[model samples]
Target chain A: MEATDRNNREGLKAWLNPSRYGAERISYWLQRLTGVGLLGYFIGHVYETSSLTQGPDAWAAMLELTQTPMGHMILLLVIGMSTFHSANGIRLIFTEGGKGLGKPGRPDYPYDAVSLNYRQKSGIWIALILAAAAMLFGASVLFGGE
Target chain B: MSETIEKLERLDKKRKEHEKKEIERSSIYLKIFRANRATGEQAHYDTVEVPVQRSTTVLDALLYAKGYKDHSIGIRYSCRMASCGSCGMKINGIPRLACYTKVSELYGDTITCEPLSNFPHIRDLATDFTQFFEHHKDMQPYIQNENADIKDPSKLSEFVQSPEDVDKFLQFSYCIKCGCCYSACPTVAMDTKFPGPQALAQAYRYFADSRDAATEERLELVDDRHGIFRCHFAGSCSTVCPKGVDPALGIQLLKGHMLGYSSNEKKIADLKERLMRK
Candidate 1:
């Protein structure tokens, strides 16, 4: 009744859920989440950088806040999120431009989608793997005590 | 499946009777969402138990509930088979054709039947498909041939095409317009103006047909921001398709043609004044 315009639209709840849908939906969920996370980080990074214009102490204070163990963990999370976003984003770019998804054909009985071919589904897996690898490597470097 | 309870059944006569009752639970509980969406009445789940046979479908179960339990329980169905595509609803949290889904095929004891999401609920289990059909209509879901002359009823001319060409768009052509794919789509759940998987797939169906000539024009229709590009390839549309019409594949291939990846450049040609002169 409240939604007379759209009528029971699932909205963000459906968009955030990657469980029921296939690999692409998982990617969809990851992409949107990471995009938002990255946007927040970008704004914070800009503010962090702009602290240098205030004074040397402000810059040092900003560094002290961000260069700690907790900050490193947050950075690690950001790294993982960004890696997933970009990796999945690349896959999406190719997919949206129609590269990896296979050609349409006569769907056989007990049908499996040719559209969700090995290449397309694997893209989500590859993005996740890439994100994991980046996070692990970033963890080693960030927390290596250099 | 009965063997799992056989061990306990042999323990005692009481246990055997209990096991028999367990095995022969003839009626299943259907937790159906009841609401007159037009009237905006209170929405609630009406759990109704209907006797089911081996071959009884979800549609049959609903019909029984409507007939015996409550005549006011509203439902829309036609052609008790899956072809008509009318009796599509969310059965056990998945969008499916009720006639196509047997009650035995459902997993749990209480099968949840609700009107399909992302559609305006008409009554209890029926949803209005006006928007969905409008999107289908917007796609111009028909062959647009520039070279055809219906001069004589006796003399018929067919557009020459190979079987290989038919294979390109044949799967997408199987769409019954049940709205199962549309309801399952995450993009459709979010964006209303998006042509949805069905229309987009049908757009590709006609686009890929060898007999159809309007390629650039069709591509132009779906190349907008809210068109094919809005689809993030969630693949749920393909997952829930009742007739195996892979709308995701069709939409992607449609995107390929839209972005010049597949290189479709067909256009309308000028009609000849006379067939004999040409």
Candidate 2:
């Protein structure tokens, strides 16, 4: 089929474009991206810490890289990704635990009722707020330290 | 040629012209996906203009294309209404019952119709729902009662249920098994083994039933790694449901039930005892 052929040509990366779906889909994609980003950063951080076994000079070189502009930008990105991932992770925990879902009602006409109630929506808003707040705090500490 | 033969040909030409004029008056453009199973041909979109009114649905448009324009256009629809659930397809980018969606509601001069996503397409606008039904069956979507009196035909009585008990699974009972929820689900698209939202929600429907005796078993069925946990609460399934069946909410409630955070066990037992007394 043309649809199957189109999917094969595009590969799984087609779903990575959050514009294809709604806000919830965009949030889902962002959560996955941030998770991957944090995992990558965790591995790199662990590897950098293990370089201390190579002696003081190697450790000094790793520390010196953090002083550069590029390293500072990378650290900022790490902070941002971690904050978003952690905040969103909390939201997922609550949803998976079924904390915010309201009582089930009859399926009425217009079919406008949604599963994500006000509580779930507020949880998502809270996650976004917390992530933004953490980013602002991290930026202040990073730039303020001369 | 004979004069009589020439006169008959003239009348035939006039009839054809009148029919053409009538067709032009009510024609609406339908961009439909088509494929042939016997010829080993690849699928492609075919644009057919057919006579339609403002209230013409996608199913009506498809039938017009099939009956007048082209007989090769494949579509599956049992009832013209939304009850049968056989006419489920993707109209534009959203999954919906083609019979329920009016042409006026759809934007653009030419309406686009395709088979439901996350299912094996049999042909144009018709997907194989075998897997969907299989998943639904795997959940054992029915009330289970082990009571001897309930089993005996002579002893069977009405199982009294409160309005509140009915409210638990009432929304979920509206599902027509359309596969629209499965198509709209991103998790089902990513992982085929997730059983999709339709089955999981129906599982919860049965689980929440006060008359059901297999609540523990039903809970265990959907508590697997790829079951309720696969749902990330995307909320797209509920958005596209024509009957307002909120499978997303049902899945979460099932999660809550499995986690021991919510239950109406005592209430159900009391209802059952009352019914038994009668």
Candidate 3:
């Protein structure tokens, strides 16, 4: 369907375009997307691991797939996503638990508060840094020895 | 009986003729959503144009359509200024006060107006605000004082506050309860359990007030799974606020307070209680 047609359908579709909003909204969409990705990976991992019950031969065949570059790349993707998700999740947990939010001051005209703003932006930065670091480590582990 | 029937038919024909002429004279077309609550009929758009003016607002256009074109159009507005906040509706997919939105400012000839999202639509442009106001009331949007003597005005002492203290919640106090913040909120759209921006912001307003004695109670009210935590700082609430009431900021500040990160110097002091005890 055309984008306009889909948008005209009704209900909330504004969140799909985070660029139209601010940084925090983008973070919200990314968090949800990463969460779903992790869930999918978990189910796949469980199925792959359960192959051990089928016998040694079946388990060996399953392990053979991981030898391919495609499998290595997939693993890297998972590692990156998980690292970002976990880091961001911790930030969310702290925020929801009401931690690290500095004192409330008297509101001035054009009333704004920067404490939460700074914390949220920093949280995103932390998650990105952790994700990048994890991907680098995974790349070395996958390709360095090879 | 035949003569009376002929007379009734003549009157009906004249009215249709008059309507055709009226439509021809109209310059601007108002495309409005129409619905009937009694029949449970499906809602549909009806367009009718009215004469335009330089100072014409969306509310004026809607009023013209209602008075001159279609009587079935439903809308709620009073105090045509932005103050009443009763005329909040989506004009071109953006939530705005109808009274505050000028028709001339809208691009193109046709203006598409719809009821605000994230609320139950009562009819054409009117949405049910019962739930909205209930959330506002739940947060105790008023100043709570335990020791103020209402019976005798002479016995009460003035509560002195510095300029800095007023600044803490001054902008948040400008909220007209328009529900624009509520409508623009993605969290409210996704999660029904969320307390919404308006309520959480007002909760902070009173919480920040030096005169209000219910700071602790207010904090506990919003410090919950469905309270301020649900807000991911979408910022739409602040962007769409016509009154410049930054509800997003209020929610964050409230979160900061709950986390023991408050920066406000003057705390809510119970002078009466202290004096009486002395």
Which structure among the candidates has the greatest DockQ? 1
Show pairs that collide, candidate 3: A102-B261, A103-B261, A103-B262, A103-B263, A104-B262, A104-B263, A106-B168, A107-B167, A107-B168, B28-B49
lDDT of 2 by residue, B1-278 (tens): 69769966776776566444432225568888776544556888899887778678889888888998898788899998899999998888678899998776665678888888788767777787877899999999887876526557886657878999899888899889999888878778777678988999899888888888787788788778888788887777877788988888888878876777676574557689899999
Could you give the TM-score of chain B for each candidate, in order?
A: 0.84, 0.83, 0.83
TM-score of chain A of 1: 0.92
Whole-model Cα lDDT of every candidate shown, in order: 0.82, 0.77, 0.76
Q: Which candidate wins on TM-score?
A: 1
Model 2 segments more than 4 A misplaced: A1-17, A143-145, B1-29, B50-53, B148-151, B264-278
Stretches of candidate 3 exceeding 4 Å from the true structure: A1-23, A53-56, A64-80, A83-146, B1-30, B48-56, B103-109, B152-155, B263-278
Model 2, TM vs. native:
0.83
lDDT per residue as tens, model 1, B12-62: 555445334433347899999998866758889999989998678899999
Tens-digit per-residue lDDT, A38-122, candidate 1: 9999999999999999999999999999789999999999999999999888888787777877766665444667667789778
> Which structure is stronger by TM-score: 2 or 3?
2
Docking class of 1: acceptable
Question: Weakest 10 consecutive residues, lDDT, candidate 3 chain A?
Answer: A1-10
TM-score of the second chain, cand. 2: 0.83
How many clashes in candidate 3? 10
Candidate 1 chain A minimal-lDDT segment of 10 residues: A1-10
- Candidate 3, residue A119: Cα displacement in angstroms equals 8.7
Query: How would you encode candidate 3's per-residue C-alpha lDDT over B132-239 as one tens digit per residue?
Result: 888899899887776556677766767888887788778788889998888888888877667899999899889888888787788788878887777876667876
DockQ of model 3 vs. true complex: 0.10
Docking class of 2: incorrect
| Candidate that beats the other on DockQ, 1 or 3, i.e. the better one | 1
